[model samples]
Target: MPTTTGMKGGGYYDANSKEQRSASDAFLPWLEEAIAALPEPASHQQSWNFLDIGSSEGANAIYTMNRLVEIVRRQSDLPVWALFDDLPTNDFNQMFLNLFPASTPALSATDVYTAAIGGSAFGRLVPPQSLHLATTFNAIGFYETRPAARLPHFILAMHPNPGAPREGVEVSTSELIPFQKQAHQDLCHFYAARAAELVPGGKLLVQVFGRNETQSTGHGLMDVLNDALLDFVEADMLPRSFYEAFVFPAYYRNIDELMAPIREEPELAAAYRIEHAESRDVPVPFNTAFASTGDRETWSHSYISFLRAFSEPVLTAALPQDLPQENTIEKIYQRMERLLIDHPERYEFHFISIAALLTRL
Candidate 1:
């Protein structure tokens, strides 16, 4: 197993990210308007560039990039150069396989050329003032580096995190300052980097899994994993240190954190003009399917698969070196699947997000 940093690659992420797609779908209208409002290019301009940052398995990335390509086609015959960027640990080969023109016959004669780059989205990757339109979906909540927060026993740093492995080991809001500051810094870098790459009047659509007034993504369901793993530690099946050490290297930003850069940082404030911003809940496909059909087996599998797609790599990296890697990973997820299948109410993954459309100034 590779010590990777992002989503599980080699086709796993491609198949299981329906919830992400649904989130992107909610922004479809914003996408269309943003594309429609593109400023006319100078007479010397040669072609257009469309970039999707943090594009995991290329499925959702391709969906949006293809749409951008299609809409641009209606406006002109300029060839489109599409770029997908993510962490080097991500599965680039799998991304390319799905992005190839042959694999997507509909895009064959569209004069769209696709390429992938591996790097931090918080860092500059392309030439300054070069891109026409750029986007990121269901990303940017990830911490550039996991904060040294003092969550002694939990899967995440969110409020209402599980208290287990040790009674009275609760993390107070004040104790989570490192995580809060880290998120602010990450967002600062993210906007600044993207600002340097986008041209004047370019549209930047950023939609990320985050916190709203009532709901926060990765909260309740993460608690389920916590309780199940705490059981493992109690039974001596896994060490307590694993629970103490494992925390998702992410922070779900509330609206305040989302706008911190704009309010506090001059670089971000002077670089772009915000066109639209929102924070709301989006429907989860598996959850919706269960609500309508009450299919425990199918919904449980889909829910667990979706979880495993993104979390498996990080969870695997947290395992003790002596354990059988594959077997232990399977056991952990298998246990969660059984838990969800038996008590559907135990699993609550609310899909809430903060999205915005900004134009480069």
Candidate 2:
């Protein structure tokens, strides 16, 4: 049998990650271009190695991997072996099952090999100088672990967008730095690890839910979740300490923030050449549906489902160990559903993403 749940957050992130899927779709051209630009495999190499870290159950991950193998087939005859990786808790059976007879039009060839590796991206999981190309899509916003400091003000590290109208909520800039610093170190470490694993001319494409000039990918969703947490607290359903200790470990960085280390830090600067980098506003299907149909119930359900998919695991973990974690989580999501269904106007969600293509220098 395969390891754990395919998609973390209880197999919820994949179906509800419409925003992430949109980001990958929007960034596909760049991904294609990056694949085309990869250096030819060395004469000593046996196969072209490709990897997707933080791929949740190979949902979007499989789609992109199929395309990658297809592109490489057009350019090289070398056998392609793809590695799909995520936390050990992630369900990998679906990813393995989907490897053959690719979801894409091409690359149905039998020569391609597929496998799953379970681990966090922060550690080295591959051999030295083995990978030819690597990609992580709509992931990496999450830290391996949360900072020890309490986020008493909000559930997420960054502030909710001002355009989002949640009255009486004050965001603390003081709370942002620890997470930002940790994220930077984490990214730098990730690059260093990849640099060691990738051949000199190997390529990496990274697309993540990210920040822009005005707001972040998480802007309004976090706001609603924040309010819901407080409501639970006020209702005596959750402990004050739970609220204080909980901060979404994810940090969505702007393109500038993403580039800081690759452009400035001596080690990363030397290891990678920035091939492509851009921040974009990706479409949200529920938001678009809400705008088009004026159907609050459908939209609210979609919205809350998306919220629970990514946020539920951490939220459930925040509860006291003795608490009925699953039941409590369900109730909290129920409240979240109501909150959005009743006042869909106030909680607006927009998906923002940043994508970059890098070359191992």
Candidate 3:
């Protein structure tokens, strides 16, 4: 299976981004502070440009942008131009529709303008020295390309195989190191690109998935899906070839990996200052609600729906074109639903997120 580069479907992401919404809401105070700290534009004529990188469907963007506009209005009457950037395949139409509802006036009758810029966030999406502030939420984990290593066949072998030794059940360093290196390189390029686009005193706030210093590299959902796929292989429901060849582009970095370039590279160090960096465990709300209510069926449906919304497109793209896409996808989700129903406790996994505030110098 060839590696896919960008997130294609918008509806799934929009529907399943509760974790993203929570994370963004948690980071709003920092966003407001960062925006407030930005040096005023040289003159009143200069419009405030706020760029939202990896903005999908504008659900979270709407809330963030509104708060930003409110803050900027208090300081100055200058026009605010909000740029929303994402892959070309993103659901931009839906984003615009949500942002500019017919019943509501745009930006509360303030001079706030919204536009979409479609492209990869890993590359340059705006002009040099154009933005006053930039924000990315639950994005930037996606690398531009997949690592050279093939997807491991026995990804879930560590889950107590009854007779097997636990010592050798881990994903080896050989399988993980290459991807870590790639992720580090991708972030360096991303920072460098943003460094060029931002003004000297501009600020950037980013929130992304992260692991603790001791935690190993891997995504929670990816782990669950790996096990689910392996189960399919065991039951002869999915081809082993497809399972081995599948690769997810998402790569989460530890705090050290995330800040490595800024700390070591002279150019980055000189161009960007790491104002604040912190990690927190972001709980899955559905799981929390489930734990209190003990509703297995509702909890299972909610958790599986979230997973299916985000992973369906990627999994679908990995399959051969000749497959009956709709039926196959439904079957896959059906199996996933059964897995969650059987093991309701699996929904309690908390996503670890790292948020950083950077200033361009």
The whole-model lDDT of each prediction reads: 0.80, 0.78, 0.73
- Backbone clash tally (model 2): 3
TM-score, model 1 to reference: 0.93
Expressed as tens digits, the lDDT of each residue in 273-304 for candidate 3 is 88888887766778788879998788878877
Ranking, lDDT, top scorer first: 1, 2, 3
Scored by lDDT, model 2 comes in at: 0.78
> Which predicted model would earn the best TM-score?
1
Give the TM-score of each candidate: 0.93, 0.92, 0.90
Model 1 pairs whose backbones collide:
none
Q: For residue 132, what is the lDDT in candidate 3?
A: 90
Q: Which runs in model 2 stand beyond 4 Å of their true positions?
A: 1-6, 9-11, 100-107, 165-168, 323-326
lDDT of 2 by residue, 1-361 (tens): 2112224543457678776788788878876777787888788878899999888756678777877877778878888888888887766655554454356423365578777888778778798999999888866778765677767767778776676655555657887888888888878878888899999989988888888888687877887888888898888788877887777778889998888889889988999999889988888888888889999889989988877776766665556876534578778878888988887766877788898889999
Better of 1 and 2 by lDDT: 1
Which is the leading candidate under lDDT? 1
The residue ranges of model 3 lying beyond 4 angstroms of the native Cα positions read 1-10, 103-106, 154-170, 213-220, 323-326
